[model samples]
Target: MFSYSILLIAALCGAATSDPSTSTDLLWPLPNGNTVGSDMYSLDSKTFMFVPAGKGGSSDVLKEALERYMKLIFLPSPVPALASSITAPMDKLTVTVDSSDETLALNTDNSYMLDTSMSMLSAKTVYGALKGLETFSQLVSTNSMGQFQVPSFKANDVPSFLYRGFMIDTSRHFLEMKTIMDHLDAMAYSKFNVLHWHIVDDQSFPYTSIAFPAMSVKGAYDQNHIYSQDDIAQVIKYAKYRGIRVVVEFDTPGHTQSWGKGIPNLLTPCYANDKPTGTYGPINPTLDSTWTFLHTFFTEIARVFPDSYIHLGGDEVSFLCWESNPDIQKWMKMMNYTNYAQLEQYYETKLLELVKTIGKQYVVWQEIFDNKLEVLPDTVIHVWKGGDNWPKEVYNITKAGLKTLLSSCWYLNYISYGEDWPKYYQCDPLAFNGTAEQQALVVGGEACIWAEYVDSTNFLPRTWPRAGAIAERLWSKTDFSDLHSATTRLHNHRCRLIVRGIPAQPPSGPSFCPHEWEE
Candidate 1:
């Protein structure tokens, strides 16, 4: 059953072996522990085995993951290597996974060990098995031998952080479902576990809300440009098998122009000399209906998105809108709320309390604490502003005994003419000055692509390899800041991404990915 290509590879200069696309010794995100041997295994003879662990094992999940990888690891053939004889294909590789029942989550165990010597993959849960499978796929390459092969190797790998996150703002511009799924596939390959879906904003509300079904019809760019309820469920299901947690972010109060379109009066009316100015700003905090709508709205949100934590966006609320509104001022004066800061605090306090009552933890932008709001101790602060001042913010947030995550340096939307990723790749999530306890309060960080100028057409290339840099920082033990061997590995990983169907852009100047990225 050998194909013509396989025969051509076999017939290439007698006794010649093929060189790998790159040094196979270099692994992306550098494993915590690993060693490669001179020996190789023929992937052409690859077979699978699952030792059924009775308690939490899902044989179907393991089998499906392996089956999916069957095509992913079939690498394109390369040139000759070592001028040697063809290596005989090995027998079945008994891949045994344990505790496969653990659903992917923030705290799911994802450590795994893969050893080709015994032809074994050792993982606790399906999440861990998925991670192992990605690594194994990276190991497969070609040679003059008539088969695809992976060198003998053993790797015991563990991620340094629990929340290796990637975010896409679909509201700024609509991205097709297939595009999001492609990014998810690449995320899974890079060991990223969280999808911070910023699903709605001022420009659009593309998420179809079941509780408020008319929201998309009223707020989305068009009837055809929205993600239906079924679309979301399919996204969640697709992510689940690949071990990614989907966290939908319905950013509120400020980035909510689209929300008021579906439900008018949700936003405060701007005023000039106490006359309606035909403009709106943040959500109207003084309205009882506002609170009531939010209660019902988030009640549905809590049910729909099963993530333990939800992003309650408390960012960029303009005080000018409230300042110009006399009724809000009147409400503030009656409550002795001398300032808009107090008004914001009052609104957030209600929202946070309701979210707590609904049985979910919450993440908010750093502005909540910066505004001196007395938030609950369990709140996770997302530090995204301050630019170079990010370290100070991270230090201050952790110093205040609140857990924090940094996204300041990882915004992938800001681009330059050449190689902008090194800046992002070098920015360490833990680069701030802090003590052991203060530093320990840092859980993880996210790389976000806000999508103002991004969409399905250019999303994959712009995001891929660059976001992979952030993933490495989150997962690896060291930052790899020196970029000695790291650059070569990154270049190779970019090619791997392209070969595996991510279509990632080249990492740096003058590189190849088996072939140039075709449009």
Candidate 2:
């Protein structure tokens, strides 16, 4: 806390500095390859064509992206026309995409080239073109002449990592569908391609499973809190259109408090004096019905979520309950399993195998590896343990040939005063001393803001600009250092987010938006 105080005090002194929309700073997740022009330019009839190139054809996806962006580009309403025409207003703006495949995946390309001088953007995919349009929208600001101005520049950019993830836990506190969509827009604007949704946890179950009608009804905070099948489909469709993948997590074995509410006889009973005490623990692994239930549940999940990977959380299994259950102990003894870890391994193995049978890969917490569980090759291990030695953990995991996503330092839920984002921006996945092959195994990283203390009311203001730092950290090819220029640039970027209606709180100590979030 004392350490963060120093950084926060530093932010207090380094408030408002520059408007990032200016030619000098003109972008967020600053383009990897850029050539900035000295002057700003205005456009003519304010229409941008979002089109496909080569053999690709038009679709509703492109039309939706263009329509949404046009409003963002001309935010606050129609820009009043000048009484007298100014010099060289462009008549058209267009972006051509090479691929019409809008199905986003682990390998989907988001590389784009933006030539503001030609009023054109080109990309290998519509996702990339969408990214370009976002950058172009960020470039809109009034010049000294009080007219819509844009910088003439060329930007060739590609994400440094394949997966730039932002995770939100809906179980801790249910977020409305509108709130989720708002964050999707914000995530896309920041070039983050993944939404690692910790959808259900010990606290609540908000995902209304189609096969299990009782789950949400019994486990959710209330009937109104559930994310209906339509809600889930809309979220998937919305995120896909924005080039973001939604990876849903249902933490198991432990974190099953909510699961117990819906499914009777699923959890292991806590015994007192050899009698059933009525209190239950994690799913009973010894029960064949447990496996059957999961097989049926995840079969439905696989069909519902089209993503290739599902986050089957294998973290923080409580030994207290397992140790308390004599039946589990007797089953363990019969199987010659000496420790609770061995029992956990049995459960995880069965679950992972079940997911594979349904033709879906899995992502687990680092605990699965710590427990010596043998996972399939496609498993994405999400590393979440914190400490200075996290780099060593990543090195070891990648050295073992398992692909992973780093979230050790980007836990936004662990709030501290001051510019904490600098630390977040500093924690690079590739900074570890590992071989090129091991480093390549680093898919990307995620900034997780758990929802125990976060919700719709304050999620925006509390997360924002700090999360933006994470956005740049994962998206840009720049090294993980918070430079002096980056401070001002990020501060400016905060203002950019505010105008775009994200309500990003100040990453710096204090700041003002040129155009406030409301208008």
Candidate 3:
């Protein structure tokens, strides 16, 4: 745990010159606001009322979120009577939306207006109201006199893109449900609406399937690491309340080593010197049993994850094992497939069809594009591994009229030394030179935290403040391009998250939150 003593020391050192008037400039995501005056509205910490009006479909969720933020931003009881006596009258923080409909649909108009003069939030939908609440919470800061207050301003805000997301790969290492929820909370705070959960990979299959219990029993890291169906429901419900869509990823074909352990002969048996090499290839794409298992497996997945889109990981298909398999080679000769890429195309085509049958659209890694596989127009292309040619690949994919999400520039797992977040901040999903239509094909992007090098303890700090950069880039105006300005706001945002109990590391240098120290 981080010590509040350091915060106290830092606060005391800066107290002599600290100015509360600057709070107006501290809002993250930089809302389009016109400052009405150089005035602030002080909150009577002990008596402020959080009223939810309009009975929006997400009224209950909004109410809970408001309560949590209120408690987090305000000082607890037991303050000196003298301080209480001098505080302003309690102000009503009213959150009003046109409707309470909580349907987690894409492009649901998360645009909101916050009127500081009226202390009210208005939005077309509950999702927008939730985003406005986050901005409102960020606007609150403590005065030198130690009273919490919000700067008086009127602002309108909306996400620049529809799909600001973060992907956490859990298969490499099982993360606790608590840890997952903690990340979701942080995502909500940052205005990230999508959680692309890479639930299964080569190392382990943590999602237990009732239809195929052996999948987890034999493939998981251990018995205790599996996520029961009930656990899945709990996570989905939790994310839903925070206005986040949880898109589950069950990586297939290539990263299915764990699956073979649970269901035998599902993998191609690689051979050496005409003898079984005791190693397996990608899922036996040539087998009828493989299709049957995949159909059943994906049917369960579709039921588990409610999001309209599923990530079908079709990346890094190493064909060495397949080449080593005599059966696969014979099949290739028989099928007249000129190359291994064609075989992968065959598998992906089948999988995509199966997913469509399950009534869910699919997102695949850039390998699908590389393989030149013909896919439905609605399929989302996740651009992750294009190396030095990444920009070209993204441009080409969009030019070809395919909707794409760029993750190549935001791979958070590639850790480096010092202030690396600016790179992520500068990565614009629409940065490429292209026609307006091509650019529009760029739906959004995600900060992928591949868990090969992360777990619960380090994942939070490593993910945050940095991922927050991408969140801002994806949400704020495309013209908002001042790195220096963004850095100052990001610094403040980091402290705000810390004060709210998220272990968000300082993006660049030393930082302190007075409220945390005071608490």
Candidate 4:
């Protein structure tokens, strides 16, 4: 963290800075492009038309997204009484994509080119087209005369990482469906491809399981707080339309108190003085019924969430609880297990196999790697806590030949008072000093919005702008290090979000939106 004086100086310097007037490109995730000049492509209600470039029928998703973008960018809020007088050359916005099939699959070819020379956007898939549309929308800004226009430029953009993601922990606080959808909308605008839904935890289990409905019925905050199967389907469908994949996380073993309440004897009972205490530990790893229950439960989750990956949280398992249980201790002794870490390894091994059996890959937290647990090559290790040695944890995990995603640098919930997003912006996923081969195993990172200090009212503001920093970091080039330039672009992006009905706070210090202030 930089000192207060340094931050103050940077803020003051940023405030006095002007937009890059000579450069027509104001993209958030800076694209790979060559700027032409200050020429502009102007549009009005009557002049703008979204057309397909080729033979196939138009995509409903693309059409709807373009319409939304048109209204949000062209139609100012509280509508100006003289708006009808605006005019421009009859301009056509053509979107060309190779495929329009919206299967909600993981798409890595999100490369798109916006040729202002021809007023056209082209991509290999609808997913890329959606990303291109977002960039195109951001390019639309006000001219000196207050008329909306997109600067003329040709941009070829692609993400720096394949799995650009944002994780929302709904277990600590049950975020309403609308809140989730709103976050999804923001993620789409930022070009995030994955939504890591931490749906269940120790506090509550909001996912209503059809195989075991009692999980949510007994564990959710209340009857109305649970997300029915339909709600999950709706959220997934909504994300699909925006080109985002929803990955459900059913945190296990450690964060299973909610599950224990839903099902009796599922958790290991703790013991004191050789007698059963009135407390319980995590799910009983030694019990055959535990495996049965998990198989049935995750089988249902696999059926519901179409994504090929499921997060089985295997972090923070307290060995004290396992040691307190006589049955677990006895089983450990019989199995020749010397420590509780070994028992955790056994549990994780079984759970990983269970997830694979259900035809899905598994993601676990950094603790799995910290404990030296042997994980399969396919198991993705999510590094959240780095202790004092931040890079070492990721280095160890990646060097061991396991894929990793770094989240230690982007915990959005751990907020300070002011100008804190730059830290998130600067923390690169590949910043860890590692060899090229080791760094290649690092896929991407997620800005985690842990729900402990967040809810519907604060979650949107708390996540946006800050999460946007992480979005740009993960998508743009690793060497793109110009904090002054980023501050200006992010400030504009925050206001842009607000205009679209997303209450995103300014990235840093005091700021004002031209449209909002004028209106």
Which window of 10 residues has the lowest lDDT sum in candidate 1? 1-10
**What TM-score against the true fold does each predicted structure earn?**
0.92, 0.92, 0.91, 0.91
Indicate which candidate wins on TM-score.
2
Mind giving the per-residue lDDT tens digits that candidate 2 earns over 111-201?
A: 9898887778888888888888888887775543556666667889888989899999999998888889989988987889999889998
Pairs of residues at least 3 apart in sequence or in different chains that clash in candidate 3: 56-99, 56-100, 57-100, 57-101
TM-score-based ranking, best first?
2, 1, 4, 3
Q: How far is candidate 4 from the true structure (C-alpha RMSD, Å)?
A: 5.3
Query: For residues 1-519, could you state the per-residue lDDT of candidate 4 as single tens digits?
Result: 111111122344354223322242246777755454445556776678777664222777777777777776574421111112222343877889777565665444788888765878898777788888887776665544556665566778888888888999888998999999988998988888899999989899888989888888999999888899999999998998888989888887898899898898899888889988888888888988888888888888899998989988888888777898878878999999999889898988988988898899988988888888988888889988864467888888878888898888788899878899998888888878789998988988888888897888799988887888899898889788788778876776776677776788767787565445222
Candidate 1 global TM-score: 0.92
Model 1 clash count equals 5
Q: Which of candidates 1 and 4 reaches a greater lDDT?
A: 1
The alpha-carbon RMSD values of the candidates against the true structure, listed in the order shown, are 5.0, 5.4, 4.8, 5.3
Q: Where in model 4 is the C-alpha error above 4 Å?
A: 1-25, 34-36, 54-57, 77-90, 105-107, 144-146, 515-519
Candidate 1 wrongly placed segments (more than 4 Å):
1-26, 45-56, 77-88, 516-519
TM-score of 4: 0.91
Per-model clash counts, in order, read 5, 1, 4, 0
State the lDDT of candidate 3 residue by residue for 1-519, as single tens digits.
111111122343332212323333456677754453445567876788777778683477787777777776573311111111222333887888888677886667788998877878888888898888877777666544667766566877778899988999889988999999989988988899999999988899898888889989999999999999888999998898888999998887889899898898898888888889898878889989989989998888888887888999988888988888888988999999989888988999989999999999989998898789988889899998765567898888988899999898899999877789988888888878889999888889999988988998789889988998899899888788787667656766766677666788767765554435222
Stretches off by above 4 angstroms in model 3 are 1-22, 33-36, 55-58, 75-90, 515-519
Off by over 4 Å in 2: 1-13, 16-24, 45-52, 76-87, 480-482
